[model samples]
Target: MMQLFRHLRLGMKIGGGFTLILLLTAGVAVIGVRGLTSIGTTVTLTTETNRMAHEALSARAQEKDALLRGEAQTITQTQQHITAIGQQATTTKEKIADPTINEQLGAVVAAAGDYAKVFQQATEVRQQQTAAEEKMAQAAETLVKMAQAIRESQYQLLAEIQEKTQVAIQANRANVDDVSQIIQGIMQLRLTEEQFRLQRDAQTQAQVDSRHAAVVQLARNLQARLQTARNSVGTQVNDGMEDDAGLDIHTLAEQIIDLLETHHAGFTLYATELTEQLQAETEMAKQARLLEEQAERIRADQQQEFAALQQLQHTRPEVRNATLANVQATEQFIRGVLTVRLQEQRFVQGADAQA
Candidate 1:
């Protein structure tokens, strides 16, 4: 081969050398171009990764904002942002050549999906809590109105009882002793009724029942005495007393009986109303307890979700912070519900108007 090259013509040898050099230069240029192309691709991938990271952080910020604002529109916006990030991550992962990077992107997509799902669940629970709170507030308002009505009824009944007692005493002046006894019994009944109104317990109810029975008996005795007096007046009339005096006594006795009967009927109705009010209060207490329990359940669920999020591996700091903010917001909401329940209890069981 060396002898052949040595014996070749000068021009041919130079042309061959030049051709070789050109081929070598072309190979080198191709290699350099490939390297530059690879570097550009790497730079592009890096820029995309940085953009995805920025998007993730922005989505996390939106999540926190949604939690702080507690608005449905904000929450929906946050969810959409997270979904977009997840989609971008998926697209980027397909382009990634490194298996490890691809896996990391997959983890990010999973985390975003989890966050969106959990956030949606939390939003649903928050809505339920709001509905429950509204219901509790409505019940409380109704209970307050019922209490006002009961108080008004008590006052009206008491006034009626006092008026009837005074009328009975004035009408039966001759039977003052009987009237006094009847008045005493009525006063005792009123005292027991007031006690029942204040306490609304079985013991106080029993006292009221006993007092009612005693007043009924006293009223019957007074009626019998009035009947006797009426008969005596009739006998006196038959024996020559003034007819006008006898008629007046009879009319007064009838008036006293009518008043007693009317007052007794009113008291019976008042007792029935008291029983109904008591039942209403009991139902209100039960509803309040149920609302409190629901609030507790919501709080527990939020805590459990927070714990689950904490346990997740490779979670971004932004996602973790957003989770914590959501938990805190849920806790605040639960505390408000508990406060409302406390107020309901006070309204249901407390005797004072301040309650």
Candidate 2:
């Protein structure tokens, strides 16, 4: 068997199969890692951008508030000034009632009148500022709406990308398992019927039976995983986060498995063509054992990875179903405004027709 394995070209079909499996797995692992990296990077970038945008908006609001406060202060000062001037004017008018004090009182009243005019002009300027402030607030609100729309779009996009990435990772995991199983099965085919019969008879060996049972269990588990994944995906696509990570993993495992089954069928067909070439060879049982060993190793590795993935999934927080009450309220308000506007427009048309 060892000799047969030695004759097995490192570039032979068996070796090539192993290499392909490794390459596929590596490619998927790299992609998965990159996707995770991207998720983190994107989240950070969006958070920073949102923070900056909100900060800028808040600053503008604060500036507007300050301007309004300053205008208020100015209006208050002007009113006080006008009140003082009026008081001064009243005193002067009282003094002017005496003909002797009339000339001095006239000058005093004239100066008070000028002060009052200045205060009036200041008040007008303050009113204009208040109007300008209102316009700015409206503009800011419009900008906020646009930003919110953009953010919502991005949120939807983010959710979609996350789902796609999860699917990809799941598919990759399944492919790796399939490749491992296929390699094991193909290698096992080299065994002589007598040798297989011997192993079957010796199935009393707990370890051998255990391994056999494991393979069968794995297949069943894969099917169950697929079903769970389908269900989880259905829910995930709806509106909220999915709590069941296993479902997703199972779904991905199924894709690889289905592909493997297809490949295995093709391989079985090809094996028919190679039967003559294989039967001519002796010590094929040794080659079978080597292949089985390789398969076992691959299985071990896969199980480890699967376990780790499961652990990670288990650690994930359950999806929260928090309600955005504010958004709901705003939607209601918008509907009300639209209804009122429609009614007002109809009333205006009716009045115009009557006129």
- Give all candidate RMSDs, comma-separated: 28.4, 42.5
Where model 1 places Cα greater than 4 Å from the true spot, the runs are 1-174, 216-247, 310-318, 345-355
For candidate 2, lDDT tens digit of each residue in 1-355?
2334334432232222222222222222222322323444323322322232222222212322222355565455534543443354345345223342334334433433443443344344445544543543343344234323323433443445564667645543553454355335323332321232233233323343343344445545645654655566685452222222222333333443443344334333333322322332222223323434543453455445444544454354220100122122223323432343344345436645654
How far in Å is the alpha carbon of 67 misplaced in model 2? 10
Tell me the spans in candidate 2 whose CA falls farther than 4 Å from its real position: 1-101, 158-355
User: Which candidate should be chosen as best, given lDDT against the real structure?
Assistant: 1
Ten contiguous residues minimizing lDDT sum, candidate 1? 21-30
lDDT of 2 at 296: 44
lDDT of each: 0.48, 0.36
Cα error of candidate 1 at position 159, Å = 32
For candidate 2, the 10 contiguous residues with the lowest summed lDDT are 317-326
* Deviation in Å, model 2, residue 46 alpha carbon: 72
What's the TM for model 2?
0.22
